[model samples]
Target: MATNGVHIIVSGRVQGVGFRWMTKMVAAKLHITGTVANQMDGSVEIYAVGASDQLAQFEAAVKASPTPSGRVSDYQATPLDPVPTFKNFDVIG
Candidate 1:
């Protein structure tokens, strides 16, 4: 299976709610490699690289709001032409 990358932006009640941490946990479970961070705009940004099916599952998990306190109103995922390489998923920023 070919690997793929996605840049995801999650909006609404995501900051200060363990969203990034939860994202990291989810990524690990799905064997995804990348980073999740809290954006200045009260949104969460995630860059994930994994198998295509795993990427789809990751997207759904993200949209489902990994944290109980987090509410994902909008989830925008864009495919990356050149997939990023990361040793492991991390909670950044």
Candidate 2:
């Protein structure tokens, strides 16, 4: 079965540690597509696309990981129309 793509923007203590790397690892493990990057507001934004179950798995992982020293709070998600172009999940600059 195919799942819809989900785009999320998380805000919190989300930069300058290992969060982005961790995100890449998690996404790779779950076979997701998109990128994770640090925003100017001191929060990390994760844009992901994949099956609903897989995206949910990444969500669960995000909720489970021990946030880095800079992390504070996570925002909500904004689901987007599926873009079937991301070949693999990555950490963007």
Candidate 3:
């Protein structure tokens, strides 16, 4: 399996909405390893590393479902040239 990575920034109504936790759940389900955190600017930032297809699926899911309380108005995902290493997915403050 070829490993890949992405850096995602989700904006709009994402804070205090379990977005990070939900992201962690999705990442775990996809066998992705990385971290999700609430940025100081009120956006959600995620760094995920996994298979290319899985990453695509993950991105799709995130955009498609912004959780019950969260409303994702916009998002940007950038492919990482050199993927980072992570043991598991986590939610960080």
Give each model a TM-score.
0.96, 0.83, 0.94
Candidate 1: deviation at residue 67, Å?
A: 0.7
1-93 per-residue lDDT for model 2 (tens digits): 675666666666567668888888888888888888877877777778887899889887776553555454666777776455687788887
Look at candidate 1 and give me any clashing residue pairs.
Answer: none
Candidate 3, lDDT over the whole model:
0.88
Backbone clash pairs for candidate 2 read: 12-72, 12-73, 13-70, 13-71, 13-72
> Mind giving the per-residue lDDT tens digits that candidate 1 earns over 45-71?
899999989989999989999999989
RMSD per prediction, one decimal? 0.7, 2.0, 1.0
lDDT of candidates 1 onward, in order: 0.91, 0.75, 0.88
Q: How should the candidates be ordered by lDDT, best one leading?
A: 1, 3, 2
- Give the runs in model 1 whose Cα sits over 4 Å from its true position: none
Per-model clash counts, in order, read 0, 5, 0
RMSD of 1: 0.7
Better of 1 and 2 by TM-score: 1
Which candidate should be chosen as best, given lDDT against the real structure?
1
Model 1 earns a TM-score of 0.96
The best candidate in terms of TM-score:
1
Off by over 4 Å in 2: 66-72
- lDDT (Cα, tens digit) per residue for candidate 3, span 1-93: 899999999898888877888888888889989999999999888999999899899998788654787788898999998899999998888
